[model samples]
Target: MISINNLSYYIGDRPLYDDASLFIGPKDRIGLIGLNGTGKSTLLKMITGEDQPTAGEINMSNDTTIGFLNQDLLSYLTDDSILHVAMQAFAETMKIQKQIDEVLHEMETNYRDELVDKLAKLQERFETNDGYTMQAKAEEILEGIGFSTQDLQRPLKEFSGGWRMRVMLAKLLLEKPSLLMLDEPTNHLDLPSIQWLENYLQSYDGACIIVSHDRRFLNASINKIVEVSAYQLNMYAGNYDFYLEEKELRNEIQQNAFENQQQKIRQAERFVERFKAKASKAKQAQSRAKMLDKMERIEAVADEAAAVDFKFKFKVKSGRHVVKMENISKSYGDLNILSHANAHIERGDKIAFIGANGKGKSTALRIVAETESFQGTLQKGHNVTTAFYAQHQLEALNIQNEILEELKQAGSGKTDQELRGVLGCFLFTDDEVFKKIKVLSGGEKSRVALAKTLITESNFLMLDEPTNHLDMMSVSILVQALQQFEGTFLLVSHDRDFISKVANKIWWIEDHEIKEYPGTYEEWEWWYNREQEKKKSSPQPQNSEKKEKAKVAVEKPRHDDTQKQLEKEIAQLEGKIEALESEVTKLETELSKPEVFGDAAKMEKTTNRYQSKKAELETLNATWEQLVEKIG
Candidate 1:
């Protein structure tokens, strides 16, 4: 639907993108990925017209619409209910409904034929726009994105920034634009909400461009991967995992070609050097030099992945019981976060706290860190020094200090060289270590904070949403660091891939109590899905005698006259169904024709007819089944 041709954007002397061309199809699900500072989000802004490209052009059809969900929406707040905000997506439908209402009111006074016709037209238009079901649609999307039914009517300003982002997401999804653009959407979402978004995008009709660091989310939701590298947009025909494998193969092939080209260039240069001085081979040497000058050199492959040689180090080994809590009861006036919850963390135990938003995952993490007060019997094991890392910690960093200086204050007692090595693992190297924290972006600040957190010689770590604002490579590095650490840690994060790799236990809050699944995230996911399936498959309990009475009350008696009438009705419905089925088949055939399908009006008309006939056929079939059951 949209085409970006030779797109280029520059900041001062730095070119973020140069001659980056990409085509977004009508139904493409594109995952835009790259390392930090790669201009993925900038591309989205350029498409949305929020940012002007330095060169090249972006073109889209006149009818194309866009819905963008970005971090900026987190600050959007108003007194309107979330449901009202979401329903705002159907502005045209709402306007039409208002016109219909006005027309009906005028008809009540005048009672004229013209008014009746106007009302009929308005109603037809409203139905075509699905105006009657707009509220339901908004509610479903809002709930699916983690808003509870009770919270739907709450003012948007009452929710936190993250929850507010969810409301914006719901509104955008409800808008159903022709091209949907989301930048790091999963960063604010919880696990269940992320899964819901994944399923929704799988069935989404429009084209989508999602820029995210969540690998699992990308793999589940997108069919194509576009990598922004070396100021160019490289298209991959498959998902993130496929891109990895394909890129590796392409890199290998390119490396081999580059090596061969280098070898040939060396041989030509050597031949020229040796034969240029000789009379017999002078012309040949000149020809070989021209060939060497004209040959296009192949660029070497640039590997995106980074290897981290540094691991988290702690001075003390904690006791077997790292942390223990009993009968924890905490509440905020009307909101009960935890009540009589009991859980414990053992030495070397890696736990992931996961659930939907508005749950007490962060609260539980704070309780573990002893930063939040509660009525509970909590105990910290011997030598269990604690270090807590959170998004807010990014603000705690001294803006005047350089990146290396920030690490020095962490007090791990590591040398400057050791700290530099740690910073390198986090993607900072050479002169980057001397860059002041004030010049760093949010993602860079997050890396710095994370580095500081890890360098602390604490046996117990409490990390809340550590993966937020981190790129996939950084997440992988943190995963590796955590895996190699000897400390006991409890973390709250929505990144499933990160959790699956680092966590050995799963924790969630249920009924205002802490719940534990003593297995990896993958295992807990399987068990949880099975449990949900069982709940869906298991029928509601009913007293057999009462159920039979209720059935008899609703069912018609199979009298002789009724049976004859039902059989006759069934036969008539069968004939109608057969005739309608033939009509539907003919419509389908016409719809497939080039003349019919090529014209928009004709295609829409034919599709409407086909759907109308199909619905009629289904109704007849259902009636036929009911009649047959009555006769039996």
Candidate 2:
């Protein structure tokens, strides 16, 4: 749907992209990736016409529409309900409905056939656009992206920036533009919302280009990978994992070619120098030199991955118990977070706190760190020293200090040489260490803060979302560092891959209590999914009698006659359930057809049939389960 040809963008004298080209098809799902400072976000802006490229052009079909979700949308504020804001995607449908309302009002006063006919036309147009279902569609998208039903009616201006960003995301998804572009979309989303978005994008009808640092999100959602590096756009046909393998193979082949070309050039130069001095074969030497000059050159591959060789050591080892919390109760206004919650961390434990937003993950972290006020008893282990790192901590770094100076101020008592080595592990090379903190980008500042946190002598660490603004390589380095660290740590992160790699225990908040699963994230995921399936299979009881009946059905054995009857009933229920499911599917297809929706009578009849069939299917499935239980 969109084509970028020979695109070149420059920031002053530095060329971020040169001779870059990419074609976005109608069904493309692209993951744009590169190291920080490689101009990923800038490319999105250029595509959306927010910024013009220094050269070349971007072209799209005349009818194509664009939807861009960027960080700037976080600042959007409005007093309208979130549902209303999302429903604004159907601007034409809403306008048509308004006109229909006006025509009906006029008919009530004038009692004219002309007004009735105009109203008929307007209502037809509204039905043709499926205006009646727009509100439900908006609500579904808002809830899918993590808004509560109650929050849907709340003013958009009342929410925080992150929440506001989710509202904007819902609006964009509802709009369903031809080309969708997102920049670091997962930054504001929790794990559940991220998974929800992944599922949505998997079935998204339009073309999408996503720039995100979360490796697992990219691998799950995107089919193609585009790397912005070395002043060019390099395309990979498959996902991020495939891109890694393919890029490695390509780099190896390129490296070999470059080496062979260098060898030939060296031989030619040596021949020219030796033979040209004697003038015996100077013509041949000159010809060889000219041929060498005209030959196409192969560029050597750049090593982008950083080696994380820095080791973390504590000044003093803590006791077996790193921290102990008991009877923890926290509240903000009338909103209760944790009540009488208990949790403990051991000296060697690595824990990950994860869940949807507004689940008190960050509150629990703050409580553990003892930085927030709570009605709780928290005890630190003997000789334990703690260091807490958060996004807000990024602001705590002295802007006047250079990167090396900041590390020295961390009080690790390390020399400048040792600190420089530590900075190199975080990808700060040569004179980059001399750059002031104020001039650094968000990612660069994050790396500097993380380096300081690692070099500290604390025996325990509390890192909240440390992987934000980090590239895949940087995240890998941080993972390696955490793996080798000797201290205990508890982290709150939405990155599932990061959690799975670093965490030996899983922590989550449920029913205003801290819940722990003493296993790896992968194990916890399996167990959690099984529990959810069990819940889905077992419906909640309306009263004690129904609950008791269900229990009796499961516990009691049946006589031969009763067993046969139960089996017969179960078979009948299953047949009915299958028929109802098929009916529901057919009704849904009918509802989606233009001929049905464009007429009010047909649309209402199809929708009512769809709902009735769905309800019938649910009851039949329930009956079949009860019959099977009785027989078993």
Q: What is the lDDT of residue 258 in candidate 1?
A: 95
Give me the overall lDDT of model 2.
0.87
lDDT of 2 by residue, 17-90 (tens): 99899999999999999888999989999988999999999999998999999888877898999888898899
Q: How far does residue 391 in candidate 2 sit from its true spot (Å)?
A: 1.2
TM-score of structure candidate 2? 0.88
Clashing pairs in 1: none
| Candidate 1 C-alpha lDDT tens digits along 475-563 | 98899889888888999999998999999999999999999999999999999999987964564342233234334433556557766
**Root-mean-square deviation of every model:** 8.3, 6.3
Candidate 2: stretches off by over 4 Å: 547-632
Worst 10 residues of 1 by lDDT: 540-549
For candidate 2, list the clashing residue pairs, or say none. none
Question: Which has the greatest TM-score?
Answer: 2
